[model samples]
Target: MNEPLAQRLRPKTLADVCGQQHLLAEGQVFRRTIESGRIPNMIFYGPSGTGKTTVARIIAENSGMTLHKLNGTSCGTGDIKAVLKDIGTLAGAGGILLYLDEIQYLNKKQQQSLLECIEDGSVTLIASTTENPYFYIYNALLSRCTVFEFKPLSAADVERGIRNALKKLSASEPQPVTMDEDACAYLAESAGGDLRKALGCLDFVVTAAPVDEGEKHVTLGMVQQVTRRTAMRYDRDGDDHYDIVSAYQKSMRGSDPNAALHYLARLLEAGDLPSACRRLMVCACEDVGLAYPQIIPIVKAAVDAANMVGLPEARLPLADAVILVATSPKSNSAHDAINAAIADVQAGRTGPIPRQLQNKHFDGEDAAVKGQNYKYAHDFENHWVEQQYLPDVLKDVKYYTFGDNRTEQAARAYWAKIKGEDKL
Candidate 1:
């Protein structure tokens, strides 16, 4: 039987892998580990088509261990125990490497089955997960494994893989198969850093395009016909979700309306309306802040409208919210001020509250407590009185740094006037 393009093109060795220079480069820990033939329990986490499975196979081959592969999505503890039993048959020989794919799918109770075997060194385990191992894998299982992160293939890497695939197809067929420059670029760029998807699109185009002059000529139209559209990698339960949202928030903070709108569109298209609005709300408070405090209510109302309308109509309100936030004068003073206060309290800087500031309206007011000396600001000039509001320990600390926007600058001037100073 003929193998699929992805399986047939799997890298036979570590050097054959395309990307992940951080891990596969010379003098790296992983290269050293493989060369030393000391295979440790590892968790390879990344997006699909990043060579996690291929890397695990290479390690097993280099280590000269009997390899047993299982899919965590389909296999259960019973399947694992069966593999362990088979490995026991070769106790005197070198141990086996159990390659578990999608190990994040294994539930907590299921993961516990490997604990004893892993601890006793009966079967060395290598697990791969598309989701973050730290969040999905059990803490105990993670503690036993050395986690290595993989990144998506670059456009250059995808192009290289496509050329290699074309070469293989030409070798097997009577006629040469070729792709035009435009077609190749389109395929590589539209794959979204996924080599498997790139190869799949290449296969589809090759099969659909008509053969001409003893060769199959692939064009931009053919590539578009096969691909239809490029997809954004935005899985709500995966790291891509967090990554895109981070980009969206950062774009708003950096005041790039174009980039911010692009990410917002991606989020809403992925049916993550709630997350999209929630991010806008965060940007309204954290980025615009006191520079445009009124924006908070507007953003909240926009988000509410988006949620109420949902989908087709939600994009309108979301777009409005994004523009309002991205174009507004940015300031983080309110956000930073709260964070500084929190840090101080967390670090044990909290002190007793001033007696006069305590609630005097509660039941019996005593002289030492609520009856303590307190100045009435209404009776003073300018409706302001000089008094210590912060705890004694934090009296010298200034948490709010004035921003460069007009509103904040005006507020800063007013505060200085009340404090009898020209500057904070």
Candidate 2:
């Protein structure tokens, strides 16, 4: 069987790895540690194709440890035990390096089974996970391992990998395989930081390209044909989902329409219409509250339209909502007020409801006394009256502070006029 181009071009040394200069750059602590050949128990956390497995393999080779590869998706406690059984054999004499890929798939008990081996120095572990380690990892097991996050490769980094792959492919081909510069760039950019994906696309296009005058030519059209859509690394249940949603809301709250739309595009591209709709409604209320109170119902209509229409049409209403919220005058006064009131209530600072504010419907002997002094504000001028609505203990506490927006300031002026306060 033919080996995959990505596997054939896997980096054998740290110098050959495509990206992650943050961890593997010369003079860096991680690089220095790997060169020192005293590899520690560590976790490789990142998206796929960022060279975690490659780096782990390089470390094992340099350290002269007996590398034992196991994927958590396929390996269980019994498989772990099988590796442990070789602990005293000559095969394990140099120490065992267990490279557990997708370590998040292993349950707590399965993870616990390795604690003894790791603690005793019988096994040096390098676990890799695409998910956030803190959320999925067994805390005890996680504590024993140092985590190194691998970031997505930049277009330049991926382009380097593509160039290398082309060289290797050309050397093996009967006719020299060459790609247009634009094609190479397009392939690298479309891979979305996944070297494996870029290489795979390259492999397919090169194999399918026709030889012209003893030279195989890959054009920009060929690259486009192979990659109909750009690769996006988005897991609805994972970090990407939350991160994009957070960026979407924050961009609107920060009043950057372009950034808000960009994140909205990401969410929509991921087919996460529900999250986009939900967050837009939240941004309208939490970030644009009071300053644009009418926007609350307007965003609700957009959200309702989005859900009813669904994507590709869903993005239309959603984008309108995102822009409206992003461009609206911003305020968090209402959100802050509710949060402060909730905090006080949760902190047990709530005193009893005042007698006048209590329910007045009861027929008991004290029923008339319960709500006796409650003044009818409508009967008074300005449809307002001086009243203590908050519990006596919190009456002096100010929760709602008017935001400095025009709408809020106008309301502030009106209330101040009605209440006869000098300050607006």
Candidate 3:
């Protein structure tokens, strides 16, 4: 390019873009929008440096659309209308696209103005936000726009980007430069799913040493020294997705708090929100149990907070919840009991419903099955009518041995009596 390597390498066409195959496919929403010359107001929500602006530029270039960009921080409510005045109506010849970045930062009023503009079709609103739109954006404006999310560039995407960057740089800067596979991989990890960051790192690596007149590869040592970022072997989306979370669950099950938190952190870093939430819920019921049942609310609150405030910011709540879940008194009586019952059922352990608890409240025939043998527990002394509930296959099966923690000891003692254990 006539500019710096970063600028020269900036993708100008949709074909040059990567990681948004979902949007770029033939006759897709994005391509259709470009072909039709009119796009509904939409938001491109995603993480930093994932080429949101680049793709926006590509769309604008292809559609013959001029744009007025408002990064939510810089413009206010009035600025929006005033710009609308300048960009008036575009019915016939061309359309004006209003590009807003970090739209989550837009206050209620600014968002409202944009909403009105979209309703009038004055301009196609193409907004981008790093934050989750549900929590940050005003629902009204969000409803008006066709929201599209931009996913973080994968390691492979970033690697491809680095190679492209080197090609562009060599076209102008000459003096062959290369990033070895290991170094490229490290650069992708260090970039944290950000394409611009990966390009920035690659730019630094090759430029670190004097340009030899021949092809020279950037080494892992040079990358480590220059970027100070570690490469993760496991795929954020695939390789370790299930395995890491499973280990995390087992760690919590085994009463290892530190290991549990480590896994929680990994989930947050990997953008695995639902997995993180599910794990916290498990930890709450299993590890934290009734002991300091207060931990349950904390875990619930964190789960809500994670959904309310996602990644980068949401990481805090997840971290806090995992720690509390990890450190709280551990118990899995409930989980073990349920799981044991599942195993019994799966093993073809069917038994007639105990006449004492059979459902029989429907019709005359159903009623016959109900009171025929059922005994109300409330009528029994202390609401303690005990009877065998396990199927024949697990007639003698027991689960959930309580931990040594004080909160669990009393429960252990109580259940141990029912279990016929020698000690609590």
Candidate 4:
């Protein structure tokens, strides 16, 4: 079988690697460490196509260690044992360097098996995981290894990689393979920071592009045909899901309708309507609270409409809710009030309920002693009356601070007038 273009284009040295400048840039700690030739047990944590495997290979070649590759998905304790058995043999003379990919898939026992080899210096481990290492990696193993995070490449970085891939393709093929500038830009932007994905797309386009006068010409249309939908890094059960949802709600709370819509579109593109809907409703109440009280029901209605219609169409109602919440006057007084009350209750600051406010039905013996003196507001002027509703300990404590927004200020004014405290 032919070697995949992405595989063929893999960086042979640290100098050739694209992106990950944070880790691999000149004078960077990681780059210095790798150059020092004293490799440590490390974990590479990041999304796919960020060059974790490629970097490991480079490290293995430089470290003078016998490199052994195993995937967590298929390897078991037996496979680990097989690798460990070579510790004293000629194959392990230079010391073993184990590059375990998808390390998150390995169970506790499987990971635990590596602890001994790692401790004794028999194996220098370089594990790569697409998921969060702290969440999936074994605690003991995690403690022993230094973790290095790999961030997604920028569009410019991916574009650099695409240019390099084109150069390599032209040199390897009998007929020159050239991509139009627009097509190169389109492929890079569409890759969503995954070099492997960009190379894969280029590979497909080159193989499928028609040869004109002994040259394969790749155009914007060819790139578009290969990547109709842009790559989106979202796993419903993963960290990206939570991150995007957080950004989605925060954008609305921050009152940036454009940013809010951008995140909303990402969630909808990932087919995560439930997360988008739930966040919109919460933002309406939490961020747009008393200032725009009616937005609560308005967002709820939009959410209901979205759930009924379902995606594509669902995005419309959800978009309306997102925009409404984003543009609405904002307040967190109601949310803050409830949280403060809950905290006081949790801290046992709540005393006995006032005698008048206590349930009368269960006060058979105490009814006569306590007296049913609950004042009725209907009989008073302005249909309002002062009453102590909180427990004795918290009677003087105020939790609901009226927000500065017009609606809340108006309500504050109305209450002050009704109580004849406006002059105070």
Candidate 5:
């Protein structure tokens, strides 16, 4: 009778499922597929506690097919061969639903073997992964499966799940557990859109309560005792690590200090200072380039200081760097300029280097060398000279569009004054 609360309250039918209305809602194609009892090879991808496994199980139950579960991290060629062997006998009657959890862990070789099963439909492949399928799963295998992305459950859905688990506990135990409204809300919100985590917390609180009879009432204090400060669910080496760092950089680029700091705190808490520092440096140059170019050195200095002094103290300079980048005038002209030039080269626009601009520093090289025609800008007024710096093929091409920021506007204006026009 001592079952984990999350398992005990797992949604039996799709209707019982709480979140994922985008896919599970009425008239959705996925919903229709599940109801028709004719499921195709599918890949469920999302964060933890997002009901990917639960939905796969629901499909298995509704499809009336024998469910063969495999952990992708551990299951090998032998396991797949055994399943394929079983499919010959068992799948002939009702077909088979193979639920592979953590499918990203399946190496390229294992995935190649699984591709055979998918192609022949020996078993209806239902793979669930926390990592992005497009990034981790093999392209051949991914193309064969319909991907459904599950989002983190909303606060309301998590609250509902908490209430349902409490009801189940009350129905089963003589001394029903009662949770205060504030305590329930706190637990649900602190779960951070993770229903299974909420249920587990509730179970732990109810089980460990120091009560021998009657109803044990849970309060906010008790909830905090079990949930602590609700650590920011981050994995230092996993997809979450990259995801949070990406968010941090985007937040800085988008000029949102609030989101930048939020992601920064998460990174620091997860001990991912190196990623945080790297992202800030890139953001400073890529997003704030030329507009407020001084910020680049500032960010680099902050990063250097952070690396020299780790942790609690490191967070200070990081916070300062993030705030500075988020508040600075944003521009991507430099970043775009490089990319545009690279794209031209990639598209066969790579013209040879202008003879004048070619190196002439060799021992025997002299004014008669290929780059002898090079004009010295310092020889002219204002240290400015208009000459063909680019290759002949790209002479008319323009890159490095000036941003709206005053610093770049000044550069544009100065260029116009010297060159008689503003186009580069």
Candidate 6:
């Protein structure tokens, strides 16, 4: 009778679990994996509030295996060995399903320690990570587990989950939480494909006990009142933290604002601090660059705001920065140019620096050695410079392909006009 709302609302069967259409569809490999009954060692990778734990539970309970659960944060090698000793001799009747929640929290040695046990069939792992396993989990241990990537639960699933939770709550208490269609969508939107967050929200809504069960229906306003979250557990200092940022950057580069925002929001909501916001400043300038100069200043402002006022208050500025960067025009000419220059260096494209830039301010002879061939931009009427910046081996090589857009076109045209005197 004292069951938590989340537990009461948890999916009782695989059918009850939401999202993962790729895995849940009929005849799918994941579906087959589930029906296989003898579950293999697996790694479940995804963000928090997603269904990683839920799916692992389904796997354990549904399998004919005996369940053994441990938090990786608290678990040590001794605990693992004890579990392994039991598992090494476990019979078919005593099949073991070991669920390691937040397995990424365990250090490298701890992860590697389980490698032998898993390989020897001493333990069947169901390790869960809110980050990419390849980065957090040891390659040895990861190789032993069948990696299954879990996606966020959809809004529809969140809605269905809410309705079912209301039904279950009604079973215990005479009254249940009520919500209208738009209210449901709003809750789901706030949840952002996280069933746990949705159910936790529903639980909060019910606890609030809106007395007016009459035509005064549950609306988005009520849902917003109930679910005011400002923190997430994902640590920003770690590698996984950068991984999400990278995903957000690439997503923006790939022109997917939805995905970029999703990743960006996850980082900020997870308590990703000012430093991450600072990194975004470079990303905006270097990646968006001249293509969307607006992003540069906005990102700088966001970083300054975060530094001046820290989080959870800092999240607003961070979110604003992400939205600005994500929505801005994107180009990778700077990135490409750097890579091309590096390629030239590797390919023996060695030459002295152009004369104009050769430490003109410095008095030494070789100081200008690096800037030997540089031309003066202020010499021409338009203050344009026409000279070879690259060494002889790389002189003919051109990097920095412009994006086919208004901003890039203007930039390329200016670059061409400035450097056109090299027709010789």
Best by the lDDT measure:
4
Worst 10 residues of 4 by lDDT: 361-370
Per-residue lDDT over 58-101 for candidate 5, one digit per residue giving the tens place of the 0 to 100 score: 88777877778899879987998877777668454688778899
Off by over 4 Å in 4: 87-90, 361-368
Instruction: Please give, for residues 159-198, the per-residue lDDT of candidate 2 as tens digits.
Output: 9999998898889989999999999999998898989989
> Which candidate would rank higher by TM-score, 1 or 5?
5
Which one wins by TM-score: 4 or 5?
Answer: 4
Tens-place lDDT per residue, model 4, 1-424, is 9788889999999889989999999999999999998999999999888899999888987788888899999999899999999999999999999999999999999999999889989999999998999999999999999999999989898999999988989998988998899989989899988999999889998999899999999999999998877577788988788889999999999999999999999999988888999999999999999999999888899999999999789988888888899999999999999999999999999988888887763567646565658888899988878998998899899999999999999999999988888998
Global Cα RMSD, each model: 3.8, 2.0, 12.4, 2.3, 3.2, 6.0
**Off by more than 4 A, model 6:** 87-93, 174-177, 180-182, 210-221, 228-284, 287-334, 346-424
Error of 5 at 32 (Å): 3.1
- The stretch of ten residues in a row with the least summed lDDT in candidate 3 is 230-239
- Evaluated at residue 154, the lDDT of candidate 3 is 86
TM-score of 4: 0.92
The lDDT per prediction is 0.87, 0.91, 0.73, 0.91, 0.87, 0.74
lDDT of 6 at 286: 73
User: lDDT tens digits, residues 1-424, model 3?
Assistant: 3345566688887778867778877778777777686667778887777778887777766766666778887888777876677654553237677778778778887788776657887678888887778878899888887778787778888878887887776766656676677877888777767777777667777778555558656889988886653333235444346678888887776767789877877776666788889877877887667666678877899889989977778888887877776666666666667787688678777677655555654446545543445556678765556676655555677765666668778776776575557452
Candidate 4 CA-lDDT value: 0.91
Give lDDT: candidate 3, residue 359. Answer: 65
Q: TM-score, each model?
A: 0.83, 0.94, 0.60, 0.92, 0.88, 0.71
Give the candidate order by descending TM-score. Answer: 2, 4, 5, 1, 6, 3
Residues 1-424, candidate 1: write the lDDT tens digits: 8566888878888888888889999999888887898788999999998789889888877778778889998999898887888656755268878899999999999899899888888789999999989889999989998999999999998888898889988887677899899889888988888888888888777777788998988899889887655545667977999999999999999999999999998898788998998999999999999999999999999999998998979999989989989999999998899999899999999797776676654536444544556778899988898888888988889888999999999988897888789753
User: Alpha-carbon error at 275 in model 2, in Å?
Assistant: 1.7
Q: Poorest 10 consecutive residues of model 1 by lDDT?
A: 361-370
Pairs with backbone N, CA or C atoms under 3 Å apart (clashes), candidate 5: none
